[model samples]
Target: MAAVGYTSGDPRKVNDTGDTLTGGLVLSGGGSNLTVGGSGAVTGDLSVAGRLSAAGVALPTTFPGRRAPFRDPTRIVTHFQTGHGWATSGGVDAPTTNLNDTTDFAKGTQAAKVVFTGNGNLDISGLSSIDLTGKAIRFQVKVDDASKLSQLNIRVGTSTTNNFQWQTLASTATSKLYRSGEWTTVTVGWADVHGGAGTFSLDANRVPSATTGFTFIRFQVVATGGNCTVHFQSVEVIDNVSATFPNGVVSLVFDDSWDSQYALARPKMDQYSYRGTNYQIVERVGQAGRLTLPQLRTLQDQSGWEIAGHAYTTAIHDSRLTAFTARQVDDELRNLRAWLVANGFHGDSYAYPGGQFESTTDGASIEQIVSRYFSSGRTVLSGYGASTNVLSEQYPPPRPYRILALSGISDASGGQGLVSSLVAAGGELDTCKRLGSWLILTFHVLTTGSTGGDDGVITQANFNTLIDAINSYGIPVKTVADVMRYYT
Candidate 1:
């Protein structure tokens, strides 16, 4: 059956301004085939006919070509090759959406992108899906603007929970963009986003009450100042069934403090010789001590204490802005950097102090206050292997630092001993499915007190036991710095 509707001209209803027209039609139980030809006009504007839409055009079965279905141009991954060129500020060049341009990133580009204004969304209507798997939505973007960057945002919602406005899977989510201005590619795939009712619907009639599906892809300018321009060139959405992690990424983190511990590991420990009644150890605790030329030589000869910084506080986590003042943050960063330099260690990655990056979840922008100051950072968040949302301007996940956390030895409150307590307390091995990410873990002297003596410092036996347990659990133990290179 071929049902077509059309209109030519007539005394159509016009608005007061005469700039627009209105019309309506209702079709009930129609004939086997009805052809309402040349009769479609709205607001009296029938000067031209744009397209001919059929009521239904059933196909034989299969078709191909699954590039893009709908586009509003809000996200960089959805720019989809606009003929009009785009530009960026900060004297930086806009990133290319072409797959050939790879850089600061090693994971490879999944989408060609350009930034766009998030507040005013790119208007799209009467859109259709090409794949129809209704599994997930997939797309990528890149934003590396240093001078100016908005909170990369994306939101899609409906009028009511059940009474929807749009019938797409992308219905709700508030997102932000990074201001780094350096093209950061992004990918959004809803194939993993699950829902019920057998098939997904984006019509205003179907709304999800207790399910997961999107209605829209609303990209946003994350920072402030009202507007932004993003460039997006291509898009490819696949089902959740095919998602895979990036290639060859290990556990997150490679802290520099190990160097100091290693320094303390060799010659220093060799100096203490067992005499008649006691070991002749001669390094004062707490207070700095002047090393006599003879003692220094003897110690050096006995053990090799490599020239390294004390590594004062490699940061348990990134600066939690909600946890510190500007001065405090500056001081902490300065102290860490100066200590690293003084100790001959090239300051690269800083473990987030308190296992965090910003102070408060809603305080001064993380990128504005922190990322700009540091080269890279690592965090304790879990990983999906491929998409680790760590310390990123677009999607800053919980504990976003360097990599996705896979497991941990100690609990946050520092409780150790007893299998029941440890189990009840639960180690940090993630149970949920991550999208392929490098997991990072943190550790300190596991004791009930402080790090000064036989009281707080973890006993060598306990340390070995913990290491063995982590190994048994199949979680890898790594320092903080190593993971930063993978994501940031």
Candidate 2:
């Protein structure tokens, strides 16, 4: 039987299973069996009971039953065996005879030891097909004399034509990656590898040897002062999962130890599974319209509320603090510290009264005094925790002591009368979610009176709204001490 179809704008003839076709043809029929004597292409899925053969046929863009590209969590590229595929050049001595040393092993029993007569290097080839974007390279190294080497250089590329080089010192400027006379695991982010200064310049597209995949990685030790021995082991390429922060962090800080905080806010916060820090003014602990010492202790012991220091009196306000002498500032801080300690409240967080401190005028002297008594201090500004921000930004050494900044839930006059303030606080919470920062909110009185009163008071209804809004974000409410512990 003949099958009918057209090819190249011309009609052609095809025969049944046993017959041969001399020209290109398309087969269509109700029967199950059809055969082609020449090359053929099928666009739809095909099923066959017997084997199908396609010689000199181009592979499809994607083949069925093909596994995903291989990715090992710790893909060890080399263990430095003698006559291993690795190539060495440039004043590098041959592999050391003593390969196994318990004192200097990072992974296997053997390692590659290279002594630099001058400047020496080693090149790892044959890895040109792997995708290395967002990957990190790690290796363990021990230096006989760190002072002899100026910097360790790392270069990665697609073959040798295109590459980027980075030095250990570049990362050391921002991170603590290098330690002298010790086994240090050096992990280099692939993104940090760039072509400039010590690296090879790339094309305009910034593609590092795009023609071939990244196959060449080189480790070079440049000699500066003298000769040194370096041991290398467990060279690996790891999938880089960059460090990240939680969704957000919220801290509810109530200042002045107001009676409403103990009577009104505490119940609502407890109902929502939340807690806050109350900066108690030592002098106003037991008077009217303030939390009593027993109430403060109850909040601390039972409710998990932090009773932090907020100075001895209102005389420490910003405007007033500018007039107070250094002795006066010392007296207020000392007395508050003594009171909190004596009351069995061993909390190490302090808040500036009215968000005011002598540091505004006396500079480091006032901050020095506050630091002497507390682990951390709080200000009425908006920022993340000090250590967290510094570590996230990868700031240089000698991190500064972070003074927690507060984003007030109340209006400029320190009252929560306006509904807009609540909306704005929600926006601040969203910002924290995006930046993974902390949002410290300040509130005073939670009474049922005028919402925007001058005494820094808000209605209990608005206080619950703010608390619910914070809850909706699902951010953890942490006390000042908890936050300090998190970063520490």
Off by over 4 Å in 2: 1-245, 317-319, 358-364, 383-404, 411-426, 453-455
Candidate 2 achieves a global lDDT of: 0.57
Tell me, by TM-score, which candidate is best: 2
Worst lDDT 10-window in candidate 1:
274-283
Candidate 2 residue lDDT tens string, 1-488:
23344333333334443435544435332213345655554433455543343463222211211111223444677766555566667876555523443456656566766777667787778774655554556666777776676667777775455566655641222122233565655554422344533244544322333322567778887766656677777676664422223555667888887888989899989987687888877777788888998899889998998888887776564344445666567666667777787788857777765444434354434555666667666665332112111111110001112343443455436322243443453344543443344456778877776454445666777777778877776767877666555431
Task: Determine which window of 10 residues in candidate 2 has minimal summed lDDT.
Answer: 390-399
Report the lDDT tens digits of candidate 1 across residue range 357-441. 4344444443333443344444433222112112111111222233233223332333322222322212222211122223233
Taken over the whole model, the C-alpha lDDT of each candidate is 0.30, 0.57
